[model samples]
Target: MSNRDYSMAFMDGGLGDKAKARYRKRRKALAKTVGMPYVIYGLDQGPGGGNPWDSHVPVIYQDPELLYLTGVNQLNTALLVDPITGADILFLAPHDAKKEFWEGKQLGVGTKAIEKLSKEITGFKDIRYIDDLNEAILEVLKASKKRSIGTFWHEATQGKKRVAQDSNYRFKKQLERLLAKERPSTKVVNIAPQAWDQRLVLDKEDIEDMREANHLTGYCFQDVLVAKKSLKTETDVAGYLNGQLQMRSPFGQSFPSIVAGGKNACVLHYTKNNDPLPKKGLLLLDFGLRWNHMHADISRTIPVSGIYSPLQRVLMDIVLKTQKAVQKATKPGATLDSLNTLAWDTLNGLLEKKVLAKGGLAKLEYETAPHRIGHLIGYQVHEGDPFRNYNDVALKPGMVISNEPGLYGYFELTINRHRYKEWIGIRIEDDLLITGRGCENLSIDIPKTPDEIELLMAALV
Candidate 1:
């Protein structure tokens, strides 16, 4: 088990003050949308929530919306934004020095240095102990003429139908149940959808942050390629990438690294990096590293032995072509739903020519790689609202989204009058910037094509 100290990764990189200001404006905007005389409470997620405290302290992530809006990334804290007032409140636990000795320093109301920093950085009107939350909420509710309260309801993977299983959801339900028991007149509102839409348009600073993250992730990916020939197993590949990321980044991987070898790649979300390397097949790597709490997601499939087979090269071209088609389709005024449809149709069109069997597409999709086209990228890996939630929302400039479309399954077809059966997985993912005319692939410069991968590998090794 990792030491508790190493479990959490955080590096503000001096962007905290500016990010907080931008987020403050976002809260005010949400305030206007929900109207003044409203109270919105956002929670900091509890310690990774699972079985008990025997394991290392998990990453005590702040609710993405809470961190996005309030810039307070600490445990045991809750934010209450009073849109009607000049500044909202941040309630945290008072310091327990004995626990701090065991765990680590926490941002509490007791420590003078922490007190000053939290106030300066968060811009909250008041920072009180967590014990004051109920009284504070009561006061805000009484003053909230709208008779409503709000909180963000996304848990990063809310699209997976496990919405009720997360801390944020529990926070929402608790508020509802509490109000029903004592304050029946008040209504609980999910301000997440509106708050999420607000994040769709990234400011210049936010975009730059993402680009920097992509640039560093690209660097680490190159380093991974440099060591790829020596990587003898899937775990070796993942470990090498993790080491590279640690060398360059204070905060490491944004998501669990996927380093699947050969048929293991057929599993779209494959994360078991324990398999031995295949001498003659492809290795799929899908990983993202974080910078300043922003995430950069990129996936590339390369050969295990530093060169792609003839068949591997051909299938790769098809996936790349589908990706290019979808890239061209992404632009301002284009709906996400349409882009997704176009991607699948274009891919199926290309695949049908290669596979001559009834229901081939269904078999591949359902049995192998069944996933939505992409999603918005930001503070959290999955970020705000799922694609389906805002499927009809037109793509706009300043928005960053992913474009990942691929097919993975056993390929059984008649080629040259011979039976061809092999499990191949080819997925090329990139972070894209939605622009006025068309979108730009932020990770495009990272070598991906057969020629690009081969030449780079040869040069490095």
Candidate 2:
């Protein structure tokens, strides 16, 4: 762990007020729509025993909705909102002086400093210990004649078996069961969609934070690009970029750094940085830096040597052209489905012209480009909706998405008489912010063009 204290910066409370305001507005809207009296959101407690790896090194991940409502980053926290009265209550874990001696300072409830910090960071005046959580829920239920209670309950994407094994999910389910037993008449409803709708649009502060993350991530990427020649292995490059990010910010990489070389680039999300750089092949780096809970997803491919070969240049140009075309078509009101279609058409056009492949565009995309053109980026590396479904969701201002166009060819898969073989796996990813006029490339600072990448690498060599 980097010896940098991100606690202060993380608690600087950038979007706390705005997020609270938005939550208030959403509460009112939900009351009018569903007539729900109160909504409860639980934050994930720092990792516990179920997963051995997680238990060893607990990864603290706050629930996105709860984090939006209350800027509390600590573990074992919950948020309760009463739509009828516009009241917000935050529950905190009881402070243990002994635990603090071993661990760190825990945020104490009702303390003078805690009160001030809560008000500044969460915009909530009422802070109570975890012991009061049950009583507080009971009080809210009794006050509302309807006895209607709302809590987030969404099926785990990974499946019920996985959720059962998850400590956090199990904890949340226990809480839900407790609520059910406490008040049998309580009408429980899922508030996940309401929260998701609100989170879809990024506020001013959210956008600014994303921009800062993108800038910092771009800087680290530039360093890695320039140092490619000196980097002996993929892990070395990942370490260097990680160190650079830590030196500047208290947070770590948004996601696991992907430093794939040569054939490994064909596997999207290849996190095994143990691969060696080929004598002369492409190096695909897909990395991002997380700052202030915001993420910047970026990917760039460059030659292990200072210059791209003839075949590599041809494949890279196709991907770049597809990315440029998609970016040009991206704007407010543009549907992701249309943009994705444009990407497919642009890449397929090259294939038809015998520039990329002989055939098997669909098969190649299915195996390699399994992911969409891009996904919404923000608090999570992959946030909100993806680029699929026709005319489902239209792009709007304040929406940030990725514009990554890629092409991966395996050695077994013959593309142009297998001349290129596994030698080509190129993906050019850049964070894009949708605007009224057009989309702005947040990762533009990092070089993408063949000449630009070669020039930077040459300087370092």
Candidate 3:
């Protein structure tokens, strides 16, 4: 018998049709808003090369955009929508007998059984194989009076020179070519921007995923605290934390765990978790979990010895205070740019007052933590660059943003006639869901106070 239940080749993460219908419906709304007849979303299931890496399971990464629109994830899934009539079609891959015993089955166009299953899963009236994608596009174009093409491709160019960002952008280029030969004087409107605008705010279904993952993210931090006493290296902490997270959720880390010890913490975006735990500094842990297609990012800077020294306590307080101030200023109308400015002002105030650092210790540069404090989080750890286009977008209810403020610097200061020299990096990151009155700190449960962390880690056997 063929693979029963038709589990996806991936971890089969999705809310099915009902929860994701809002995203699919956006295609129709987007087409109308952009004045296009048809909108096409063609997503490729990667590593499609035949018989390569056989038997070795390579996990599939679902693009945040694709997953947001269609909850179900599999190989080569596409959706074609005709805004004129508010009709949509879901394209999928058919079953293969060869891999039935191992990789299970996928949704596709076929017999009544297959069609019903696809319809029930995707909530689309029409279900077809991906092979029909080209023909479907041509027909949608030909049938409509509008001489135009609709697809999401944020084309990056240096004056007509094609400069794509990543593999996804490269693949979108292929879809552009499919529609380029359609006819003369065809209008190409990029629906991608509109889709991104729609994605900025989370719907009810999305918020649930975000909240669950966030709660578990804090739990994962507590799990590490219990084992941190025995974990002597950064790599060990990362491995153990990630292992415990996956044991609970279907998917694992949003990105490689950033486990930095002591001065290594100053190296932002540090992923080389091989340093030994230092006897006199902080350990920065930055990690997130993927739950139900939504991601939650959290960062905590804690003392390596389960107790913060006077100097370490000041540094930790600086970061925690900066984060608290930003969180307080997060309102529905405040923009990311404004929030980030508030973060820096708060940090600088603390340092300028000799609360933690001296004048020479704080500098706004790539190595420091002031430039980029947070990013928009969702299906991916980073949805977009906060300093770029995402900077000025006003925080409305349902919009989620990250509030992380810290200082990363190298300095030597004399305290009580004792000279201290090290690279100090402390960052506290939490997801803030913009609410009507204010914003909710989704990761607030994660222990960050020196007293709380000391108590938690001190419990370790």
**What Cα-based lDDT does every candidate model obtain?**
0.74, 0.70, 0.72
For candidate 3, lDDT tens digit of each residue in 373-417? Answer: 677887667775322467787778988888888778765555676
Alpha carbon lDDT at 368, candidate 1: 26
Model 1, residue 125: distance off in Å is 3.2
Query: Which residue pairs in model 2 clash with each other?
Result: none
Ranking by TM-score: 3, 1, 2
Comparing 2 with 3 on TM-score, the higher-scoring candidate is 3
> Model 3: clashing residue pairs?
none
Best by TM-score: 3
Clash counts per candidate, in order, are 0, 0, 0
Whole-model lDDT, candidate 1?
A: 0.74
Judged by lDDT, which candidate is best?
Answer: 1
Compute each candidate's TM-score over C-alphas: 0.88, 0.85, 0.89
User: lDDT: which is higher, 1 or 2?
Assistant: 1
lDDT at 286, model 2: 85
